[model samples]
Target: MSRRTPYFFLLPAIVFLAWFMVVPALQIFYYSFLNYSVFSASTFVGMENYRRLFADVNFWWTLLNSFLFILVTPVLMFLSLVLALCVRNLQRGTKLFRTFYFLPVITPIVIAGIIWRWIFAEDTGIANYFLSLLSIPNVHWLTEYPTTIISIMLVTIWRGAGYYMMIFLAGLALIPKEVEEASLIDGATIFQQTFHILIPLLKPTLIFIFVISSTAAIKIFTEIYIMIPGAPMANKALVSFLYQQAFERFDLGYGSAVGVVLFLITLSFSYVNIKLIEQRG
Candidate 1:
């Protein structure tokens, strides 16, 4: 019950986090300056890895693709907010709709990505099968760069929508009913109520989603890895670049450089998330 007792209780978690997270993060920065693999002795290379990375044509392209992934944030926000509104206005089956949409959120990402890869298969996949019925030819869903990124983005959106929708639903619930009723009495149209009233009140919720979702977009790895498993050259993104260099190629120093960059990029967004949460008061 003493103030010091609270610190004693928290000590274990603090120690665990520092050892696991902080130590590895520091190691990554330290190792990035070295030129070595797992088997070889590390030699301090003085930013040689970064110089090479910057010189690599694929690195710039990969960086662009990583930013491209940020597009998912706005798309997710729109879909989730719209779905939240729809569910809120429904007369019944609210639980059913919520459950159904949220089902994908519970499914394991690797398993879902594997199923989606099959569904998007060029010739015999269900996605193409449906398109066939509509007289649309099979479009290469996962093969080409453009479609590959788009397919991954779609999967991200589908998997994320239900969760964000629930958050929006919570935000909607917090709004006072009297404000809505007052708006209705003022003869505001649905569009007017949404743009003028609901959106303004939901600014905090929207920004919260934006920060978290943007962070996720930056760290995108699993979906691209799963979908493009066989095609290493085509897999161009910050994390993908890191994986290929560090794990696949066994160039630990080069890989650590990519990791450092990825860490910095994700760290900035994480800082924003923390700041937003603090200011949320």
Candidate 2:
């Protein structure tokens, strides 16, 4: 009885996850092989949905856009690390600075997105107002694809950097002071210490953040949707494509196919991350 006690304590969470996550994921996999939709009766149509998925040009574009979004992760990693370092080295107002920096993360995404929408607005936006200070033309930020994507990407960074910074700060705090003292006593420069000793020690934290950020980037929908409501089909995120197909068009089967692909991609990427980490170990 004692040996089984820990498992009992964990059982509720396991059951909860199985009921909510595993079951729904399995249903999506099953639906992807069917011709299920709201308007029509479901029928088994093995691989037909996937065939349609591959054949769709919009899907390819969205996939490419998703990959492009992955670039946001490394940029996030850098920004977060810098913020963490700055906060760590501060002698005063540490808690205040941390709270201010993390303020965006706690803000509701809808409110943040809405506020950013105005910031990126073509004519009356603050962004253009600032650009005008430099004598640059009024760029149609939300209207143009190249700039529109970049603007949305910036919003993501704005909201996410603080969260990642918190993680990095926690990791930095766990490092022993002895390690830094030893390095300093060896006459290591600040840059050398950071690159060689500190960062290398924070490898696990960095890997964890990378995995999390990359997954979020691939699954990004709300930020893109809220920022660029009128974004063209070719620039939509993969999840946006799935959302439109499922909810808007009522093509649940095809959307499930997309979901299945996304699931596989995320799974494979996580596996690769783990394998790389293990190999390094």
Query: How does each model score on lDDT?
Result: 0.89, 0.91
The per-prediction tally of clashing pairs is 0, 0
Best by TM-score: 2
lDDT of 1 by residue, 107-190 (tens): 988988999999999998999999999999988888877778889999999999999999999999999999999998999999
lDDT of 2 by residue, 1-281 (tens): 69999999999999999999999989989999999889888999998999999999999999999988989899999999999998888999989988888889999888888999998788899999999999999988888877777887888899999999999999998999999999999999988999999999998899889998999889989887888888887888899999999999999999999999899999988997898689778
> Model 1 — TM-score against the truth?
0.93
Q: What lDDT, from 0 to 1, does candidate 1 have?
A: 0.89
